[model samples]
Target: MKTICGLDCCGACDRKEACGGCLKTNGRPFGGTCVAAEWMKKGGKDEFLRLKNNLIDEINSLGIENLQIADLNLLNGFYVNLEFTLPSGQSVKFLEDKNIYWGNQVEIPESDRCYGLVADDSFLLVCEYGCGGADPQIVMFQRRQAGTEIKKQNLV
Candidate 1:
């Protein structure tokens, strides 16, 4: 079976043996009290599975007929520049980047802190910071179409 890296999917943490994260002690990535895990477990297995499917659906709905992967730079993080057309006939240029952290939770740098963007499909993009007992802030952004008079939806 094929597997995705720790990027979009959960993988066995190399630091799990010595790390103090719940996943490290539990031997499973999803079953933990971590914020992300807790969010996923809120409604049990079905909800978690639904959330995963929703993420996949959002990616597919982007209709990425073509995709390009850019060079990975440690300082700049891993980036991918996407040029794709939306179903509404609008063209979109999206840049996505991923940074890895070995701590118990993910943190977004102060410079990167901003309101999150949520897709029409309910998938959210936000900066997650802190670990263990730290409370993460949920930043929200407004997404809008160019030249359209419609008000943008406040993403949460």
Candidate 2:
């Protein structure tokens, strides 16, 4: 079992049997490109690390209380594709089910709930939810401004 980004995701993942692995599929695990692996393949580790660190800084700058993001790991889209109810009374999911993303889970200070942070090259999403992502509420959803590459500057 090999990994594109050197993370032991395949060993820890429950879907390994069905998904094979990132290395086996050339980063297209589960029929979707893994963001971390794709970035690593294109730019090597340093560039990917820079992108991850920059994204962390961008997420932290949002000023959401106690939502500091330390590190982001490769995450399956379906795992974080939480449904959010809009102010217009419509429930929606913002992420593609088969896509991969960089995300982190930050536990809100002194609370049982947690903040779920998910991002791609195009957007940043923050949501709050109870145990097991139950009763989720969208805290923030912002898209990257046009022509602003995530590696070059702030996301929004």
Candidate 3:
């Protein structure tokens, strides 16, 4: 099986040895829960798709220039997690290396950089990075407002 998130699991992942793939690991690859797998397992594929589509809508509505998102794929945290330097000079990573989240990549129109977007049920993270994900910089990180949570009851 590719993935419970309805996306190909082996597309571009580099942690297959550690992850054993989502299906082989029973949805808990890397010894942690994948938000996409958990949601899809709990509420079914259609519900999970709704949640993902809703998130895409939310990201688009942010009015970020050149960030018109089309879809969010199931991304392993280890692949998309990049350390970001804050204004205070402290660097931090907002994602767990073992968890899975919904994310996408959008290239800047006139630059060599690309925008990386990662989101779970609680927050939205936007970042820019160079080729091979070098020099990642945080563009924005926002806590998803109230009433936007996607749980079992919220799936409908």
lDDT of each: 0.30, 0.83, 0.83
Model 2 stretches astray by more than 4 angstroms = 145-156
User: What value of lDDT does candidate 1 attain over all alpha carbons?
Assistant: 0.30
Q: What's the number of clashes in each of the models?
A: 2, 0, 0
RMSD of each: 16.0, 4.6, 2.8
Point out the higher-scoring one by lDDT: 1 or 2.
Answer: 2
* lDDT tens readout by residue for model 1, 46-122: 45445444443443344323211121111111211223345686765433222221111122345432222222222
Task: Give the runs in model 3 whose Cα sits over 4 Å from its true position.
Answer: 11-14, 151-156
Model 1 residue runs over 4 Å out of place are 1-11, 23-36, 67-156
Model 3: per-residue Cα lDDT over 26-92, one tens digit each? 7899997788888787777777877777888899998889999888787888888898888899988
lDDT of 2 by residue, 1-156 (tens): 889888877787888877867888899888987888877777677777877777888888898999886788878898999988888999999998777899999988889999998888888889999999998999988995343342433222
What is the TM-score of candidate 3? 0.86
TM-score of 2: 0.88
Worst 10 residues of 2 by lDDT: 147-156
Superposition TM-score, candidate 1 onto the true structure = 0.31
Per-candidate TM-scores read 0.31, 0.88, 0.86
